[model samples]
Target: MEREILLLGNPQLYEISEDVKKEELEDLRPVFEDMFDCIKGIRRDYGFGRAIAAPQIGIKKRLICILTDKPYVIINPTLEFIGDEMMELMDDCMSFPKLLVRVHRYRHCILRYTDENWEKQEMRMDDDMSELIQHEYDHLDGILATMRAIDNKSFVMKKYANPSLSK
Candidate 1:
């Protein structure tokens, strides 16, 4: 099933998501399936979504689906390390596709997460992948890119924003 991507005004987007227990992994397979479907649908409609957190679909679980070189599910993810280097980028979210926020993010990070089958895994990511994971991780913590904006001048409507700022 393809779930509806919750919008900015939705209060659920502001609430912290609960961590999914390893035992619940099997039961949440359907939610994972729906997340992937939702992401694909969003990419088809908007042309620019690489990942989505469970909260984006009204699922208050610490889960995220990322579409990178390969699609994969991450459950109970944690940022093990964030590099000192920072980069500023205009970030957009599935929840607020029409708005872009200029935010600072780590240039690299080490993330530890559990796979769909509850196997533990870790990956070091840099550049786009690092930014993407950090964005999704914020959703798990009830933080929006808008909240991380540099300042009042750091936001703009997608159409009015700089073309180079597309992320």
Candidate 2:
């Protein structure tokens, strides 16, 4: 089932997500399925959405579905390392597609997460993947990119923020 991505005012988006237990991972197939469906739906509508956290769909679980060259699931993700280098970029979320927030994110990081089978895995990611994972991880911690905005001037409507980009 395709789940609705909770909007900015939705309380579920602000609630801290619970970590999924190893035993319960298998039972969460439906939630994972729905997350992937939600991401697909968002991309279809917005033309750009690489990942989505469980909380965005009101699941309140520490899970994120990412689509790159292929689809993958990350359960109970943790940032194992953050590089000293930082980069500023306009970040958008599925919850607020019309808004873009300028935020700073690590240029590189090491992330550890569990797969669908509960096996532990770690990967080193460069700026793009690191930023994407950080954004999704913040969602798991009840943190929105809007909250991480560099300043008052950092937030802007997507249309006004990037005129060159298609709506």
- Writing each residue's lDDT as its tens digit, candidate 2 over 22-112 gives 8897789998888888888877676678899999988889999998888889999999556489999999999999899999999999989
lDDT of 1 by residue, 6-94 (tens): 99988999999998987788899998889889888877666678899999988899999998788889999999556499999999998
| TM-score of each prediction | 0.92, 0.92
* Candidate 1 segments whose C-alpha is farther than 4 A from its true place: 160-167
Which residue pairs show collisions in model 1? none
Model 1: lDDT of residue 90: 94
Runs of candidate 2 with Cα error greater than 4 angstroms are 160-167
Candidate 1 TM-score, true structure as reference: 0.92
Candidate 1 CA-lDDT value: 0.88
State the lDDT at 128 in candidate 1: 86
